[model samples]
Target chain A: MTQVIDVYDPSDPRLDDFRDLNSIDRRPDLPSGKGLVIAEGVLVVQRMLASRFEPRGFLGTDRRLGELSDDLERTEAPFYRASAEVMADVIGFHLNRGVLAAAPRPPELSISQVIEGARTIAVLEGVNDHENLGSVFRNAAGLGVDTVVFGLGCADPLYRRAVRVSMGHALLVPYAWANSWPGDIELLRDNGFRVLAMTPNPEAQTLATAMEGLARDRVAILVGAEGPGLHARTMRASDVRVRIPMARGTDSLNVATAAALAFYERARR
Target chain B: MTQVIDVYDPSDPRLDDFRDLNSIDRRPDLPSGKGLVIAEGVLVVQRMLASRFEPRGFLGTDRRLGELSDDLERTEAPFYRASAEVMADVIGFHLNRGVLAAAPRPPELSISQVIEGARTIAVLEGVNDHENLGSVFRNAAGLGVDTVVFGLGCADPLYRRAVRVSMGHALLVPYAWANSWPGDIELLRDNGFRVLAMTPNPEAQTLATAMEGLARDRVAILVGAEGPGLHARTMRASDVRVRIPMARGTDSLNVATAAALAFYERARR
Candidate 1:
C-alpha cells in the first residue's frame, strides 16, 4: 500500500517533479529533454496506476487522495497530500483536476514486439500535435486498434498535454517510435499486414470498401498530418490508399478524427 | 472596399470592439454573458467574412491586412491596422493569430429553418464545452452533416472559443437551439428524420449496422455530455440506441470524435 505524506511546504524538494509544469516538458538533464510522463485529474491518475508506467510519486489534494485510495493500494509510491492552495503554489498554477501522477519514461517497445500478434494497427506520420497524438491513442484504445506505431515527425505521446488529452490511453496503449522511416513500414508488410494509407483523394477506395475487402487480413491504417497529409514516399510504400469519402468541397477531416473513422471501420468488420 | 485606417495609438477607441479579447467572451450586457463572435487568424477571418455574421470592424497587424486584401475588397468595414505590440496592448495579450474580427450576435434561427431540407443533423444535449461544440461543427461540415440542433444544456455556439475551434465552421453551418427539450426531437421525427441516440451500452447496435439500416432516411445523431451521456429521458425518446463498438474495458471516445465516427458512417454509404 502507498504511504500518505502530509506536505505543507510549497518549495519542498520532494515536490520538484511537479513544479512549473508548463515548462517541465523541457528537461535538459534528461536524454531527450522530454520530461517524465505526467497524468492529471483523478480519472487519468487512476489510468496511470493501471498502466505499465510506474508512478514515481503523487501530488494532490486530500479529496483526490481519498478518491484514489482504492487504486493506490497496490502501488508503493508515496502520495504527497497538500491543501489545494499549497498544491497550486507548488505546480505554479491552479489545476482544476486537483490530482496528478508522475511516471518516468520507460524504454520504448520495438515495432516487432508491438505488432507481434496485432490484427489492426494505426501508423501515424508527421502527426506532431500533442492533442492529436493523444486523441489517436484514445481512439485506438476505444475502437480496438491493437497497436500504435509512430513514424517520422510524431510528437511524444507521453507529454503531459498528450497524456491528458488521451485520457491516459497514452500509457495504456502499446506504442513504439519507428527506428527507420518508410523502411519500418516494410517491416509491417512483411508481418502479413496490409498497409492502408488514409488519403483525401476522391478516386481512392472508401474506408468502408477498403476495410471490408481486407477484413480477413491483418491491417495497418496509416494517417498523416492534416494539411500536408502523407509524404509521397510514405504513400508509395503503402499497399493501398483509402479515403473516408468526405463531402464535396470539404477538404478533409481532422487527422485524428479521420484516423478514428478508419479504425472504427476496421473494428466493425 | 474596406477602409484601411492606420492607428499608431494603442488606446484608439475604434479598436474597442477588438480589445481585451481574453475576457471579451464574458459580456455582461449580452443575454448569456457571452460577447460578440470573434474570428482569429487569416483563414478563420476569411471564413467569418463569408459567413452570415458581418464583421463590424477588424484589428490586425499590417501583414494580415495585406493577406486579407482580396477578401476585404467586397466589404466596407474599417480595418484598424496596428503594430504587433500595439495590437497586443489593446487585446491585453499577445495576438499570435495576428488578426481578429468581431461580429455581434444575430437573431437566433428557428429550429424548423435549421432542419429544413436536412438529411443528417446532430442534436447536442448538455455538451457545454466550447471546444467540443466547435469540433462537432467542423466535423459536421467536413462529413456532410447538413445542420445542428441544440436540445438542452448546450453552450453558446457563437462563443469566441467555439468559433475558433470550429475552424470557422460555426459561422458556416446552420444551428438552432431547441425551445422545447426532448419535445423538439419529435419535430425532427415529424420531418421524417430517424433520431439515433449514441450510447456506450454493449447491447446497443453498432453505429455501422444501425446507420446502414437507416441510410435512406433522414437521420439526426444525438449526443450528450462526455461523462453522463444522454439523459435517460432523452434516450427513451430516441428511435434507436446506437453504440460505437469499443474494445473491452475502454471508456467512451471524446464526445466530438464519437459524433464524427457516426457522421462519417452515415456519409460512407
Candidate 2:
C-alpha cells in the first residue's frame, strides 16, 4: 500500500518533481526534463496505475486521495497529501483536477515489440501538436487502432498536456518514434502491413472504400499535419492514398478528427 | 469600396468594439455584452464578408489591408488601418492574426431557414465548450453537414473563440438554437429528417449500419456533451440511436470528433 505523508511546506524539496509544472511541461526536450511523466486528475492517475507506468509519487488534495485509495493499494509510492492552497503554491498555478501523479518515463517500446500481433496501427508524420497527438491516442484506443507510430516532427506523447488531454491513454496506448521516417514505411510493408496514407486529393480512394478492401489485411493508417499533408515522399511510399471524401471547396478536417474517421472506418469491421 | 481611415491613436473610441476582447469573449453571456460578433485574422474577416454577418468596420495593419483590399471592395465599411503596435495597444494584447472585423449579431436564423434543402444536420445538446462547438462547425462545413441545431445547454456559437476556432466556419455554416429543447427536435422530424442520436451504448446500432439504412433519407446527427451524453428523454425522442463502434473499455470520443465521424459516414456517398 502507498504511504501517506502530510506535507505543509509549499517549498518542500520532496515536491520538486511537481514544482512549477507549466514551464517544465512546455520544455520536455530541455536538459533538466527530469524525464518524468505526470498524470493529472483522479481518473488519469488511476489509468497510470493500471498501465505499465510506475508512479514515483503523488501530490493531491485529500478528496482525490480518498478517490484513488483503491488504485493506490498496488503501488509502493508515497502519497503526499496537501491542502489545495499549498499544492497551488508548489505547482505555480491552480489545478482544477485536484490530484497529480508523477512517474518516470520507461524506455520506449520498440516498433517490433509494439506492433507484435497488431492488426491495425496509426502512423503519424509532422503531427507536432500535443493536443492532436493526445487526441490521436484517445481516438486510437476508442476505435481499436492497435498501435501508434510517430514518424517525423511529432511531439512527445508523454508531455504533460498530451497525457492529460488523452485522459491517460498516452500512457496506456503503446507508441514508438521512428528512427528513420519514410524509410521505415518499408518496415511496415515488410511486416505484412499495408500503409494507407491520408490525403485530401479528390482522386484518392475514400476511407470507406479503402478500408473495406483491406479489411482482411493488416493495415497502417498514415496521417500527416493538417495544412501540409503527408510529404510527397511519404505519399509515394504508401501502398494506398485514402481521403475522407470532404465536401467541395471545404478545407481538410482537423488532423485528429480526420484520424478518428480513419480509425472508425477500420474498426467498423 | 471600403474607405481606409488611418488611425494613429491607441485610445480612440473607434477601437472600442475591439478592446479587451479576451475578457469580453470570456463572458459573452454577461449582460454587458456589446451584442457584437468579432472576426479575427485575414481569412475569418473574408468569411464574415461572405457570410450573413456584415462588418460594421475593420481594424487591421496596412499589410493586412493590402491583403484584404479585394474583399473590401464589396463593402463600404471604413477600414481603420493602424500600425501593429497601435493595434496591440487597443486590443490589450499583441494581435497576431493582424486583422479584426466586428459585426452586430443579426436576427437568429429560424430552424426552417437553416435546414432548408439540408440532407445532413447536427443537433447539439449540452455541448457548452466553445472549442467543441467551433470544431463541430468546421467539421460540418468540411463533411457536408448542411446545418446545425442547438437543442439545450449549448454555448453561444458566435463567441469570438468559437468564430476563430471554427476558422470562420461559424459564420459560413448556418446554426439555430432550440428555443424549446427536445420539443424542437420535432422541427427536424416534420422536415422529413431522420434524427440519429450518437450514444456509447453497446446495444445501439453502429453508425455504419444506421447510416447505410438511411442513405436516401435526410439525416440529423444528434450529439450531447462528452461525459453526460444525450439526456434519456432526448435519446427516446430520437428516431434512431446510433453509436460509433468504440473499442472495448474506452470512453466516448470528443463531442466534435464523434460528430465528424457521423458526418463522414453520411458524406461517404
Candidate 3:
C-alpha cells in the first residue's frame, strides 16, 4: 500500500513536483524544461496509476485522497495530503480538480513495437494543436484503434493540456512517433496493413464504403491537419482515399473529430 | 460597400462592443448579460457575414480587413480598423485571430422551423461547455446534419467562444431550444423522425448497424452531457439505443466527437 504523508507547509521541498504550475518559466510539464508528465484530478490520477507512466508522488487535498484511496492502495507512491489553501499556495493557482500526480516520461516505444499486434491504427500528420492531439488519442482508444503513429508535425501528446483533454488516454494509449515521414508509411504496407488516407475530396470513396471493403484486413487510417489535409505524397502512398460526405458550404470538421469518424467507421465493420 | 474607419484611440466609445473581452463582468458576449454574438478571425468573420446574425460592426487589423474585403462588399456594417497594439489595449489582451465581428442576438428560432426538411439532426441535453457545444455545431454542419434541437440544460449556442469554435456555424446553422424537456422529443417523433439516443451501454446496437437500417428515414441523434449522458427518461423515449464500439478499458469519447460519428454514419448512407 502507498504511504500517506500529512503535509502542512505550503513551501515543503517534497511538494516541488506540484509547485508553481501557472508559472510560465517554471511549469514542470514543459517538454524542453522539466519534462514531467502531470496527471490532474482524481479520475486522471487513477488512469495514471493504471498506465505505464508510474506516478512518483501525489499532492492533493484530503477529500481527493479519500476518493483515490482505493487506487492508491495498489501503488507504492507516497500521497502528500495538503489543505486546499496550502495546495493553492504551493501550485500558484487554485486547482478545482483537487488532485495531481507527477510522473517522469518513460522512454518512447518504437513504431514497430507499438504496432506489433495492432489491427487498426491512426496515423496523424501536422495535427499540431495539443487538445486535438489529445482528443485523437481519446478517440483512438474509444473506437478500438489499437495504436497511433505520428507521421510528421504532430504535437506532443504528453503535454499537460493534451493529457487533461484526453482524460488520461494519452497515458493509456500506445503511440509512437514515426522516425521517417511518408517513408514509414511504406513500412506499414510491408507489415500487411492497408493504409487509408482521409480527405475531403468529393471524388474519393466515402468512409463507409472504403472501410467496409477493408474490414477483413489490417488497416491504418491516415489523417492530416484540418486545412491542408494529408500531403499529396502521403495520399499517393496510401492504399485508398476516403472522404466523409460533408454538407455543401461547410468547412472540414476539426481534425480530431474527422479522425474519430474514420476510427468509428473502421470499428463499425 | 462597408465604410472603413481608422480608429487610433483605444478608449473610443464607438468600440464599446469590442472592449475588455477578458473582464468577467464586462465581457460583451455573456448570455446572462449582453447576449451578443461574436465571431473571431477572418474566416469566422466571413461566415458571420453569410449568417443570419448580421454583424453591426467589426474590429480588426488592416491585414484582416484586407482579407475580408471581398466579403465586406455586400455588408452595410462599419469596419473599425485599428493597429494590433491598439486592439490589444482595447480588448485587454492580444488576440492572435486579428479580427472580430459582433452581432446582436437575434430572436430564437422555433423547434418546428429548425427541423423542417431536415433528414438528420442532433438533439443536445445538458451540454453546457461552450467549446464542446461549438464543436458540435461545426461537426453537425460538416457531416450534413441539417439542424440542431436543444432538449434541456444546454448552454447558449450564440456565446462568443461557441461561435468562434463552430467557425461561426452556430450563426449559420439553425437551432432551437426545447420549450419542454423530454416532452419535446415527441415533437420529433410526431414529424416522422426516428430518434436514436446515444449511450455507452454495451448492450446497445452499434451505430453502423443502427444507422444503416434508418438511412431512408429522417433521424435525430440525441446526445447528453459527457459524464451523465442522456437522461433515463430521454433514452426510454428514443426509438432505438445506439453505441460506438469501444476498445477495452477506455472511457467514452468526447460528446461532440461521438455525435459527429453518428452524423457521419447517417450521411455516409
Write down the RMSD of all candidates, one decimal each.
Answer: 1.9, 2.0, 2.3
C-alpha lDDT (0 to 100) for residue A143 of candidate 1: 91
Best by DockQ: 2
Q: What lDDT does the true structure give each of the candidates?
A: 0.92, 0.91, 0.89
Model 3 chain A lDDT-worst window of ten: A23-32
Q: What is the DockQ for all candidates, taken in turn?
A: 0.83, 0.90, 0.84
Task: Tell me the lDDT of model 1 at B83.
Answer: 93
* TM-scores for every candidate against the unseen true structure: 0.95, 0.96, 0.95
Report the number of the highest-TM-score candidate. 2
List, residue by residue over A1-269, the lDDT tens digit for candidate 2.
99999999999999988999886565456454545889999989999999999999999999999999899999999999999999999999999998999887787888988899999999999999999999999999999988999999899899898998898999998998888979988999999999999999989998889998998999999999998999999999999999888787587889999999999888888
| lDDT by residue (tens digit), candidate 3, B39-74 | 889989888888888899999999999999999998
Candidate 1 residue lDDT tens string, B232-254: 99999999999988898798899
Chain A TM-score compared with the true chain A, each model in order: 0.98, 0.97, 0.95
Write one digit per residue (lDDT tens) for candidate 3, span A111-218: 899999999999999999989999998998888888999998998888888899999999988999999889999999999999999998999998888988988999
Model 2 pairs in collision = none
Instruction: Supply the global lDDT for candidate 1.
Output: 0.92
Deviating ranges (above 4 Å) for candidate 2 = A26-35, B26-35
DockQ of 2: 0.90
Lowest lDDT 10-residue stretch of candidate 3 chain B: B23-32
Candidate 2 chain A, run of 10 with poorest lDDT: A26-35
